[model samples]
Target: MNNQDDIILRTDNLTKRYGGVHALEEANFTLKKGEHVAIVGDNGAGKSTFVRQITGVEQPTSGDIFFEGKRVEFNSPLEAREAGIESVFQDLALCNDLDVPSNLFLGREELLFKFGPFSILDEKKMMRKAKEVLERTAIKIPNLSNHVGDMSGGQRQCVAISRSASFASKLIIMDEPTAALGVQETTQVENIIRGLKDQGVPLILISHNLRQVFNLVDKIWVFRRGRIVGEVIASETDGNEIVSMITGMQGGVHEKASYI
Candidate 1:
């Protein structure tokens, strides 16, 4: 909020297109240090598309991304993670067949030997570390030996979030984190989000739940028709104002369309 130095992430005219159809167009957005912001809109409003671009799941057609005051163009999700950006998509991306520890250390497994493909897994060590991560995030999974597929939806969602929180050094992004969850499960996930805020970790949450958005984030960014239409402080705005922006009915209809 102070200046560019205070910004953890910033995008200048970020755009994405498929043929002539623009999924996301010139979306200029920002997140400051230790701030939580939500992206809310109707379907096809470009929330996920914008997130995909930021997480390096897809390259932007044209834009400059600044993270921690340095310009960066990530070629893949791996690159983005290495640069301290971790994302939890809707799929959760956990290995269903693998047990909790294995899923937690899926790609970054510990090895007893220095071998590549033939390396012996240090299963005990990975399990210990996984337990530590779960504890740190206040996530409870009774048995670390249980296959992730055997767990309930909420536990699996917690695992995905725990994994992201454990490794995210700079920023964490969540897309529809609680869309598939029920009331109890949603509360569990929301508590985890609050934990992230307590740690002062900056986050970008994409959610359609205005109630949840109002409860969690410091600011709300409304997207309409592939473009970022408006931003408002969460404490100062209500659901109706945000709904108006999403439906292009805030200003006159044509006036809102002018952003596109």
Candidate 2:
């Protein structure tokens, strides 16, 4: 945990439930601006649910969410995005039939006057911006004209990450970012993540890869079932200790670790 001044996003007594089934049990979390935090948990834990609530995919049953310095409620993902919260879900939400530029600018496209009363998509402008975003992120792909269907898993993931990072001004939520990537591809994606970190993008990465989490994040938040159980600064703890906490061996150790 870092100092309170560094925290940019936080949830107080956040909770969610599905038809009387409590999916999240008053879980709390805090993220500092420009800080990289990893959320690690098992299958049944509320990591996904917690993320869903924060991103406006689902609403919390009871809680308070604060972004920047204002407390607010988001009714939809777009609302969350408008508030500078971007999420890269495990599905990666890329249209396979579309080209790199098309996928990058999906839903939000550039348009210019064509006929007297009608406008057409400005493909050239969108492609230029897409290329610029890719270059800025140091991402390499086959070509901007290449169809996403023809791309490898890692390439598609990079596009997804880049799309989120492009609009993300404060926070980026990544769920299982490297779940299906190969060795080389994982390295590439990891480098892209580091690049975002270098630019001071705050991230909440949900992963099962202990090595990746320990190596990249400034802090780790461990979740068990539906509650946040522990949080440890990456520099102050080892993977083994985190593993023990995740498996129920340790008890509320991180309660003392929350500085912000």
Candidate 3:
């Protein structure tokens, strides 16, 4: 990555507090267009808060968020989505009872006006779009009408990812994307992530799985005590060092906690 180029998103003096608890503290972060960045930390280390601010799921008590070189304040996640930011949370926001295509095009449904002012959902068009989007990531769904509840964990995750890719124009943030999957399923989801990367959609991945983080992200940012402790390029660091930081054995400000 070059020091001089376009930046898609950045934060300055970002802070978030709940009552007296600081979830994020004066953290500065950046994401370059087409870059895949991973954030890892132990529980209560502010990973979720950081992503919440970035995705506009929660407002930062203080700080300015920049998107595509312009300062913007997002009041809600919908605002962020309108600005071309899509997120896949750990829950994936999937509808268990709905079919794959329905879940894929959930909120943003297509409307057809066969009668003026009395429009109905255009299911065929949405199904076609769903199939196309799923294919973009090489996700093989034998039937688009299958209920998501019946799909394998990996397939459900892929559907969620595909939905984000289908809607996101600039960035996608995924939180604990493969947390409940088996090894094979996790790899399937990782391949979908790689496909997203190849297509130039910058992604922010929030995961505690160091091995997955190392294998998928180009860079890793470590968080401790609601603050960013360090940022390391994947080529320059390993999971053991990051895990040590997460446990406070070693990092920006703590170096004596104990790695052994």
- Which candidate number would show the highest lDDT if scored against the true structure? 1
Error of model 1, residue 35, in angstroms: 0.4
> Model 2: per-residue lDDT, tens digit, 98-151?
998888777667888656445688999999989988887676785889899898
Model 1's TM-score against the true structure: 0.93
lDDT of 3 at 76: 90
| Comparing 1 and 2 on lDDT, the stronger one | 1
> Where is model 3 more than 4 Å wrong at Cα?
1-5, 114-118, 251-260
What clash pairs does model 2 have? Answer: none
Predicted candidate 3 versus true structure: per-residue lDDT over 80-167, tens digit per residue: 9889999999888899899988898776778876555566889999999998888877767789898999988888999988888888
Against the hidden reference, what TM-scores do the models get? 0.93, 0.90, 0.90
Error of 3 at 138 (Å): 2.7
Model 2, position 214, has a per-residue lDDT of 80
Q: In candidate 1, which residue ranges exceed 4 Å CA deviation?
A: 251-260
Q: Write out the backbone clash pairs for model 1.
A: none
Ordered by lDDT, highest first, the candidates read 1, 2, 3
Ranking by TM-score: 1, 3, 2
**Model 3, residue 167: C-alpha shift (Å):** 2.0
Tell me the whole-model lDDT of each prediction, alpha carbons only: 0.89, 0.86, 0.86
